[model samples]
Structure formats: structure tokens, C-alpha cells
Target: MKLEDIPRLSLGFLPTPIEKLERLSTDLGISLSVKRDDFTGFGGGGNKVRKLEYLMADAVAQGVKVLITTGGHQSNHARMTAAAARKFGMKPILVLRGNRPDMYQGNLLLDHLFGAEIDFLDPDAYFTEINPRMAHHAAEAEARGEKAYIIPLGGASALGAMGYVNAVKELAEQYAAAGTATPDYIVAPVGSGGTLAGLHVGCAMFMPKTEVIGIAVTGSAVPFSERIAVMANAAAELLDYDRRWTADEIRIENDYIGPGYSIPSEAGNAAIKLAGNKEGVLLDPVYTGKAFAGIMGCVKAGSIAKGSSVLFIHCGGSPALYPFAGLLTSDLKEDQAG
Candidate 1:
């Protein structure tokens, strides 16, 4: 089936703005632009909304009443999934990875505000225990006479990746309308690998000349290139496209992850401040900040030549910034004092 035939809900604002980061471009000595997925304008807005549009549409078609998903405590995906479920009059249940914190902040606060039913698991148990049991939880819901649909962490399934496929198409149109050349590189954060996978497939089919780069937010527990290739091929299969991707096609830089997932790093914190000060754009420490730091690192390493055209996909987690206010403020003050 063609991608056009796939089920999708029109939940997010279409064709999110792609703007030039003029000041950042000058500072980096590259032609830099950002695709503002943050402005998707639903449930705090993020790249996940694009994926949820397709995922939730399937839920609606399957006559699901309860939607279940998993993520980290500060998961932007979980919060967005909750909002989309509520928008469609479905109950949302989130199986989160970390234990409940003493205070609700960032996406956790929004998850509660959305009235989602939340359960927590120890970080270690999240992978070995909670993930394996989600299907059982869905079956239990079915036994209760409620239909349940389970979305994997980050909505990383083949169907969800279609959102990014569609995003690349929208971006191509925007670039043409604005009379700009296609970027040489497209950069984004990689967690569950769905967004990057979609971009890989979409770029192969739509913008074959461009290269896609995924900056790892999670540590190297899994080989992201292999995972991304599998997702991309799966998405291509869903669209009835004949193309296949190899793991080598995916280029990932792991240096910026710093400590581990969700833990803020010095380079990421600095990138957050730089984006805010240079272009008046906000980036969350967990994802975009780290990914942007990778972009800067590439520039500094001379891998991305000066004046090379580059596009950064801002996947959006600004709401999560509130939880780290003390860390950010104190660090900035320290930098100034130093």
C-alpha cells in the first residue's frame, strides 16, 4: 500500500516551520537551519506527535478505548501519548521506567495533568521486567472488557515511523517553496530510533543526496545503526516500497551522551544556553541539547566543512527544562563567575 493509504489522525499542525538560525550559522561558520518540530502544537509539542498521529489512528480504527505505552519518567513521548489518547476520548496508561520522584515536574507534571494512569518500574526492571509484561497488561485490560492498544517506547514501531517519512515530504516542499537547496546533512536525536529510521527511509526515497545523522541520547546498550536499519526497512515495507537499508547507512555520534540517558552533560548544557542566547531558541538537556552538541562537535572536528548546509531537527522537550532549573541556573552563574 502507498503511504497515502495509511491511517493517520490530523492531530498536529502540519508543515512545522523550518527557519534559518542566522546567528548560530555565523558562529558555527556553517549554513545552519532548524526544523521546528517543537511547534507541532499538541500536548506540549514534540517529534512524538508526528508518530502518535499514525499510532493513535490505528488505535481509533481498532476501536481501542485504552492506550498503553512505556517511557522514562521525564518522557516527552509518554506525555504526548497521554494527551493524544485523551484527545480521542481514550484512556491512557503509562508504564514509566523510573520510580516516582518526590516532586512532579516537567513531562511528569503534564502526564498527571492529562489524567493518565501511571505505573512506575525500577530502572533495572524496566528492560527485563516491565517491557516484557506490557502485553500481559493489555490482555488483562481486554479481560476487563476494555480494548487496549500498546505503543512501544517512543512509538518506535514501523507505523509510527511513517510520521517522519511524511515529515521529510513536508520539509522537501517547504525547502522548494522557500527556494533553498536541500541540506547536505540532517541531524536529530536518537533514542528509540524511530525518528532517525523514518528520516533514513524518507531521505533515501525523497532526498537521496542528503545524509541523516542520529546523535545518541541513550548509551550504547543496543547497536542503534542495526536497530535503525531494521526500522527503516520495516517502514519501507509498510509503504510497499522495495528499498532496503544497511546498518552502515546510519551515522551516529555517541560522544555527547555524557554519563547516560536523561543525565545532563556539560556540553549539552552549554549548547542549550548557546541556542537560547544565539537564536532565541530553547533546547532541553535530555535530547535536543545533546544532539545539538554533537552537531557543534562535528563542526569543530572539521567533519562538517565550513559553509556546508545543515539541517537540525529540533524534536522538542522544552517543558522538561523546568525540572532542571536549579542545575541550569547555578551552572550558568558559575560559568559567568569563572
Candidate 2:
């Protein structure tokens, strides 16, 4: 289906800014820009807002009375979905992974503030076996005569992935207006792979010259690449596009993942500090921080050629940093030294 065919709701401050990162770029010896999808205009502003526009539109069009989604403990997707549901006057019920901790922080706090009903699963069962629980929750909701739609992690569905396709198109338009060459590389953190897949196809369709780099914030490069290919094909078919994406079309960097999903890396924390101190940019421990770390690694390794323009898609998870505030703020470089 074409973009026009998808039901969409306005959730973000559209055409998010593509601004030059002169300080960071100069320090790294490259021309770097940022696609500030972080400022997506709701609940601390995140990439999820873009995906939810289409997802919520579909929900509303289907006469959905309640929305359900699954995500990690401090899930940006869950928070954004709750906010969007509130926006449309629909109830949001989030089935988050892991146990509900005593102290609600980050997205969980936002969930409560937004009046979303949240249920947590037993740790062992949740981590190792969440799919069945999520399915069961949907079934229960259906049995209760309430309309419920289950959104996957990170809102990574074909309809949701269309957000990034539209994003690339927006970025290309911004470049054309500014008379700059399309970005040499477009980098983002990958969790469920939809964003990268969408970008893979979007760049191919619109900005063919740009390379899309996915920093694996969770999984390994192998499965991440495979999943991206799978999703890209699905997205292409959804849009009825003639072109198909190959594995080579997607590039993934695994160096920044370091430990595991939601775990912080030293490099990632440092990168977060650098961006905050130098450019006033905020990236959380989960996604954008890891991605920024990868971007820095690319610079240090000369993978991002000197003077070549690179665009880092700030896919937003700033609120999640609340839970890891101590971790993120620790050992930060002294801003005064610079």
C-alpha cells in the first residue's frame, strides 16, 4: 500500500529538524548532522511517536476501544502508546516485560502519569516466555468484549515501519532545500529492526546514495541483519514497491552493544555525556546512546571518512535515563575542561 493508503494520525511535530552538529562534527573531523526525531512532541518526545501515528490511526479506524502493546521495562514505545491513546480518547493497557518494580521510574512513571494500566509478568516467565502471556492478555481482552490491538515491541510492524520511510523522504527534502549532498551515512540504533528496514528501503527509494548504518543496541549483527532483510521485504510488499532489498543493503555495527539490551556501555555513557555537554543533545542509555557510541567509533576508526557528512537519527529514549541516572552521569567528562 502507498503511504496515502495508510491511516495516519498527527502525533509528532512533523518534518523533524535536520540540523548541523558543528561542535560534534568538528571535534570528530567530519560533517555530522542529526535527524532530531527525539523532539517528536509527546511524552519526552521519541521515535515511537512517529510509529504510533500510523498505529493509532489504524486502531481508531478499526474502532478500537483499548490499545495493548508489549515492550521492555523502561519502554519508550509503551509510554508513547499510552500518550497517543490518551490523545485519541482510547484506553491504553501496556503489558511490559519483567516484574513491576517497587519504584516506578522512566517510562513506567510516565505510564502512571498518563493513566495507563500496566501489568508485569514474572521475571523468569516474562523474559523467557512473554509471547504466550501477551497473546493471552489479548485473548482475555477480546473475551471481555473490549477491542484490543497488540503492538509488538518497539512498534516494529509494517504499518509502523512506514514512519521511517516517511522520515527518509523528509530528510531528503530537507537536504534538497539546503543544497547539501545526501548524508553519506544514516545511523540509528536497532532493537526490533523495523526502523532500519524502513530506512533501508526508504533510502533506496528516495536517497539511493546514502548508506544506512544500524547500530545493534540489542541483538547480534547476524540475526539483526537477517531480520532487517525480512522486514524490508515485508515493508516493500506493503507499499507495493517494485524494488527489493538485499542483505548487503543493510549495514549493522555491533561494537557498541557491549553487554545486552538495556545494559549500558562505558563508551555509550561517554558518548551521551559528550553530546550533552558539547551539543546540548540528550540520548538515553538504551538506544540513541549506543548509536552515538557507534558513530564515534566509526569516526575514530576512519570508517566515516573525514569531512563526509553523516546523519545520526536520534530515535529518542531520554526518559529511560531516569532509572539509570547514576550510571549515565557517573564518570562523565568534565565539561569545564573543554
Candidate 3:
């Protein structure tokens, strides 16, 4: 099937705006622009909306009424999935890692606002048993005579990643309309790696001149390149693209993953503040913050050459920022302590 032949829901604001990072560009000595996937304008807005457009389309086609998925407590995916499910008149069940916090903040707070039925898994079993937990939810929904559909963590499935494949085509059109060549680098965060996989496949097909760069947000025991290649090849198979990718073909930098998943890093927090102060753009500490820090590191260290035309795919997670307000605003506390 062609990329366009895949089923999709028009759930997000497509062709999200690409804006030049004027201030940051000057600061970094590079021509930088950000593709604002954060402004997709649906289901709380994020890059997940792109994936959910395809994933939810399948659920709608199958007449599924209950959407089951799993993720971290601050998972932008889970929050957006919940919003998508509710908007489509389906019940959303989120099986999240980590115990329920006393105060729901960030994505967890938004998930609650979406009225999603939430289950908290013990951190011990969150990695080993999340799939089964989702399956259990499906079974329960089945027992209640409700049809259920399961979306993998971060909607990382091949069908879901096709959303980014389509996005590449949209991006190509935008650049062509502006009479610009393809960007030298396309940078984004890598959590589940689905978005990065789609980017790789899409770049190979639609924007060969552009290099896809993934900054790891999660510390995985498995190599990101290997996992991303497998997914990219699978997405390519959907379009009969015929190109099989080796792990080495995938470019992912893991230097930015400080501490661990969901834990804010010093560099990430600094990046978050920089982007906010420089661009008035909000980036979550968990994902985009770290990835932006990677971009800063790459540019400063001469990995990405000066004056390179770089595009950062700003996958949205601003909602996750609220949960870290205290950590992020400690400097303010010294002066404003009332």
C-alpha cells in the first residue's frame, strides 16, 4: 500500500507551522528552524497526535469503543491517546507505570481531565508486564461486551509510525513552497523510537537530502539504531519501499539521556529555560528538553557544522512541564518566598 493508502483520521491540525528560530539561530551560529508538531491542535496537541491519527483510524474502523494503552505517568502519548479516545466517543484506559501520585500533575493531570480510566502499575513490573496489563484491560472490556483496541506504548507500531511518514511528504511540500532545499538535519527526541523510525523511512523516500537525527530520551538496554531500523524497515514494508535498513544506517545520539527516563537532567532543564526565554516556546523536561540539549551539544561540539540548515521537530510535551514547576523554578523561590 502507498503511504497515502493507509487509513487515517483527520484528527490533528496538519502541516503544523515551521518557524525559524531567529534568536537561537544567532546564538548557535546555525540556521535553525523548528517544525512545530506541538501545535497539531488536537488531543492536547503533540507529535503523538500524528501517530494517533492512524492508530485511532484503525480503532474506529474496527468498531472498537474502548482504547487501551500504556505509558509512563507523564507520558505525552497516554495523555493524547486519552483525549483522542474521548473526542471520538470511545472510552480510554491508560495503564501507566509508576504509582499514583498524591497530586496528579502534567500529563497525568490531563489524562484525568480527559476522563480516561487509569491503572497504575508498580515500577517493578511496569517494564516487564505493561503489555499484559493492557491485555487485561482489553479482556475486561470484552467481558463487559465492549470491543477494545490496544495501542502499544507511545503508539510505536508500524501503522502508527506511518503518520510521520506522511508528515515527511507534508514537510517536503512546505520546503518546496518556500523554494528551499531539504534541510541538512532533522532532529527529534527518541523515546519509543517510532517517530524516529518514520523519519528515517520518510527521509529515505521523500527527503533524501535531509539527515534524520534522534536524541535518546530513554536509556534502553537495546541499541536504539537496531530497534529503530527494524521499525523503519517495517514501516517501509507497508509502502513496499523495498529498502532494508541496517542498524548502522540509523543515526541516534544517546549522550543527552541524563540520569534515566522521566528524570529531568541539568542540561535538559537548562534547554527548557533557554527555549522558553529565547523563543517563548515550552519544551517538556522529559523529552524535547533533553533533545534540545543534544542539539546544543552537537552544535557547540562541532558535530553539526556552523551555518548548517537544521530543523528540529519539536514534538510537544509542554503539558508535562507543569509537574516540574517546583524543580524548574527553584531560583524564583529564593526571592519570591512569601
Candidate 4:
């Protein structure tokens, strides 16, 4: 499918700034920069807007009256999809996996504000398990005479994966315009793997010289790499591009996913503080923070050598910080005194 054929809502602030993190670069002894997709124009901004452009297109094509998707309690994808569904005059239903907390915050709050109907499922409900459940819900909607669209978690479908592939093309142009050497490495957090997969194929087909790295925020490298390979191959097949890349072609670094997914790590927190202090950038705890730590570790370990440029894709989730504000504060008393 040609990218131009996809239906995309005007969601993100396009051509997000690509800035050189000179302070961080100097501190880490490597040339580090950022592709600020965080500024993607909308509610708190996130990478989901990119994927939704295509997914929503399909939804509209199918005459969908409602869009259904699944995610964790504080899923940026669910929040953004809710907002997109509203913008497109469709209702959005979110199936939230994980333990249901008493308090609502972060992306969950945004989901509420957007008026998205949410079903908090059992903690043991995995993504695969939630798939049929979502289908059932969509089917129910259809039975009631409503057309519904079921978007997979992270919008990992071939159409949704095209977003990152298109983003690669955009990044390539950005690199050319910046007049810097092409990125030696491109880094992103691997959750559902769609973003990583898109970047893998996009970089391979467009920016052949660049190496794509996936930092697993959840799961192991073996499965994440395999998922990315599968999605990239599927995406390529959809585009009718007869090209293939091995697991070696796409690198996965697992040093920073400390503890588990959505759980904070010392290195991740330090990396978050460093980016904010040095570059005035905000990275969420779950995705970008861990991915940034991986990039930092790779530089420190000589995996990314000195003088080589590395581009960290800031898949935005700044909203996730609000719910975890308690984690960010050193002292509540200090706040009151101030």
C-alpha cells in the first residue's frame, strides 16, 4: 500500500524538532541527538498519533462507528486513539489490561477526559487474550447495528506499522536538511514492536546506512526481535517490496528495562533527569526513559563509539509522569513549604 493512500488525521505537530543534545553528548562522550516526536500535536503528544493515521483510515474505510483497542491502565496508545476517535466522530472503547487501581491518573485521566469507554480487565489478561475479547465486543457492537473497528494493541497491524516506515522517510529528509552525517544508530523502546518494526524496514529501505536499535521496555530480545522481524516482513509485503533483513540487521539492547515494564529503574530515572536538565527534554518513565538509558549504556560500553552520532526517537509519553508524580517528588513537605 502506498503511504499516500492512508487516511490520517492531522494529529501531530509535524517535522518535530531534531536537536543536538550537546550537553548530554559532551557528558556521555558521544554525539547524541533526538527526534522529538514527543511534540506530535495533540493531547500530551505521543507516537500513537502516527499509527492511528493509518488505523483510523482503515476504520473510516470500513464505516466503523466505534473503534476498539487494548492497552495497559496508562496506555498512551489508548488515550490517543480515544482522542482520534472523537476527532473522527467515532466512539472509542478501551480494554485496559493490568490491575485496576483505585486512583485514576496519567493517561488514564486523559482517557476519561476524552470520554473513552474503558473496560478494566483482569491482570492476567495478556494482549493475545484481549484480542478475542475485543473482537467479541466489536461483534456485539455490530450485532447491535453498529459498525466497529478493532485496532490491536500498539496498532501493530501492517497498516499501522507503516507510520514508522513513513517516519523513517521523514527522518531521512530531516537528516539531509540538518547537514549532519546520517545517524549511525536509531533507538526506540520496544513494547508491541510496531514502531521498532517500522523503523527497521524504513531505515533499511530508505536510510540504508543507519542501524536501527530496539530497546525492549518489556519482554526479552529474542521474542521482541522476532516480533519486529515478522511485522517488518509483513509491512514490506504489503508495500510489495521484496526485501528481507535478519534479526542481526535490527539490534536489541536489554540493559535498561530494569525490574519490568512500566516499573522505574535507577538508570532510567537518571537518564530522564539528565535529558531534562541538559536538553530541557522530558522523557516518561516507561518507554523513552529506559530507551535513553540503553542508548547511554551503549555509549558508555563503547557499543556506540565516540564521535559517532546516535538518534534517540522520543516516542512521547510525558503524560505518564502525572500519575507517578509521587515517584518524582523527593519530599511532599518541601512542596508544601515552597
Stretches of model 3 off by over 4 angstroms after superposition: 334-338
> In terms of TM-score, which candidate is stronger, 3 or 4?
3
Give the TM-scores of the predictions, in the order they appear: 0.97, 0.94, 0.97, 0.94
How many clashes (backbone N, Cα, C below 3 Å) per candidate? 0, 1, 0, 2
- Runs with alpha carbons beyond 4 Å of true place in candidate 4: 220-222, 331-338
Q: After superposition, how far is residue 47 of candidate 1 from its true place, in Å?
A: 0.4
**Rank order by lDDT, top first?**
3, 1, 2, 4
Model 4 lDDT on a 0 to 1 scale: 0.84
lDDT of 2: 0.85
- Give the range where candidate 2 is weakest over 10 consecutive residues by summed lDDT: 329-338
Q: In candidate 2, how many Å is residue 7 off?
A: 1.9
User: For model 4, which pairs clash?
Assistant: 12-41, 13-41
Model 1 clash pairs are: none
Off by over 4 Å in 2: 220-222, 332-338
What are the per-residue Cα lDDT tens digits for candidate 4 across 216-322? 88774347767778888898988888887666666788778898888878888888888888889999888888899998888879888888888989999988878
Give me the displacement of residue 280 in model 2, in angstroms. Answer: 1.3
